[model samples]
Target: MTAITEALRRLPKVELHCHVEGTMRPSTVVELASKNEIELPTSDPTQLYRYTSLDTFLEIFWLVQSVLGDGDDWARLAYESAVDGAEHGLVYRESFFTPARHLDAGQDLGDIVAGLAEGCVAAEEATGVRIMLIADIDRAYGPGPGLEMVQRLVELRRANAPGTDRVLGIGLDSTELGVDPTDFAPAFELAGRSGLRRTSHQGEVTPPTTIRAGVDVLGCERIDHGLSLLDDPELTQRFVDERIPLTVCPNSNIRIANAYPRLELHPYARMRELGLLATLNTDDPALTDLDLTYEYRSVMDAFGYTWDDMVTIALDGVEGSWLDPTDAGALRARITADADQLASSLATG
Candidate 1:
């Protein structure tokens, strides 16, 4: 690794778009598959991640999700995911866990949340990296199930069930094509009423109108993968004026969605230039063979961003996070202090 890349690796970073299941190690997948009695088409770790499109990627993502047969499996997955991210300088994260399939398979939501909480707490103690959960609604399952999931989540919170406290918000992901964001509005609304923060994956393959629906109809506090927002100048300006956060996963767009043929062609720089609150993240890090540090280095190299530019992006991550004022101030201070030290070391070295 280059000095810059190495330093970037050690720089404290926050991730908001990561999926916990997507962080499962390849070897862990093999073990989990065996434990769950699920058959794999291939045991080769390298070959496992090769995919041509988003749908193909989801097939693999779902396969990974299927491996968690119980709470213990989930705890293991969460623990390893957080630990791996911590190694890459992830100091704080709001990780997504979509349990629709697991729920449909007769697993209790409480068990899943409790298991994830147990694992994340362990990881926090070990790495000093804090993580909170966002329960995502799988759009492929349709609106009814989505609402049901949120209702159950509300019930868990009402009962003060284990791990519900760790779940700070709700989000909608998976299969955006041909699905209306408003269909899940009831779920998002209920979550809002229950004091859950909200966000949704929009514009990855859809248009700006869907992105608008995500914000207006669903009342999402943030938008994930709002790649198509620039397609509508008016909407883009609104996002800029409002400083709405877009959790952008540039490499994932290239590798999974095929939205752009290369990283250099991505609209990330354009988004920033327009003064939109676009934060860098790795949507499915392990699946795409990505980490936040490499993400920083690649964006810097691709867009000719200097260390200061990268630091700005890192700070934007803090601003875009779901952290409250006091906690956010503390995290921003930490990143600033660490960045100052790292920059001094780099200058000297």
Candidate 2:
């Protein structure tokens, strides 16, 4: 492989929009289901993740979350999930976990947290990848349960303490079609009060107006699937000016059949051209059947990205992450050094 391509292979990335349930390895999912005596909707692992429609995909997604029935399930799920991310050249991964989904399945919140914490520790040790949890509150369930979910999430995070150094942020997910960002102001405010980093899925299925509502009303520091944010030129200009990082999942969006079919038609390249902070991610790796390196390469192969363009986007991920300044600086330097090495090789060639 060329030096640039090799750099892309070993180049580390920070994942900001990964879903814990959707990211489970199909093999691991079956093992967990078998161990817990939970029946899967699809016994075959390959057929389990062949999702096309957004609605059906969500149905299957919730079904798998159901198989993770107890706290130990959460621990094993969390731990095993991170290893997959690490193996894919990801140095840092913040997984979105919805405890309410598990607890509503009759699993206790404490147990779920305990299991996830165990998995986080094991995964970190196994792969040398740092992992963090982003507590996700499903909007379709309404704000009352969301309020309780956040409270329990905070308690869960505090309970694990130093062992699970990975619990870091809160995210708003689930269908955004009916739920307005303003509906859960109280929950977000509570998250802010608790000092958790905040992000939300805003415009994946909604118009650019919904993105405005999220930035103005909900006060999210970063946005997941904020593709529609490009619709408004002035607003897009502001996004570029502010450098608000957007975690763009082109394959995931296309898999949902929500966006254009081709990668060039996606907002990722436009976001980059406008100088907006855009980072690539596998929102659901198993569902999309790809990793960070593969996603980066596909984006390049489809969009014809140059070495500098790709490296700059990698740097943007480090700048856009919730990592402490020191960590961010370290990752940034690694990208820079890799880029320089690739350039030197190109010059020699």
Model 2: per-residue lDDT, tens digit, 1-349?
Answer: 6555566766677788888887787887788889879888778888887666777788777777777866677777787778877765777877788766665666766666567778888887888887778888888778888888778767766775433456676888887887778888888888888888888988898888888877777788888899888888888888888888888888788876457877777878878888888888889877668777778887888789987777887788787789999988988897788678767776786
> Backbone clashes in each candidate structure, one number apiece?
0, 4
What ranges in model 2 sit over 4 Å off?
1-6, 156-165, 342-349
Model 1: worst 10 consecutive residues (lDDT sum): 43-52
lDDT of 1 at 2: 82
Candidate 2: lDDT of 46?
Answer: 88
Kindly list the per-residue Cα lDDT of model 1 for residues 1-349, writing each as its tens digit.
8889988998899999999999989889989899899898898877777789999999999998998999999999999999999898999999999999999999999999999999999999999999999999999999999999999999999999999999999999999899988989889999999999999999999999999999999999899999999999999999999999999999999999999999999999999999999999999999999988889999999999999898888899999999999999999999999999999999999
In model 2, the Cα lDDT at residue 133 comes to 80
Candidate 2 vs. true structure, TM-score: 0.92
Q: Candidate 2: deviation at residue 168, Å?
A: 1.3
- What TM-score would each prediction reach against the true structure? 0.99, 0.92
| Candidate 1 off by > 4 Å | none
| lDDT of candidates 1 onward, in order | 0.94, 0.79
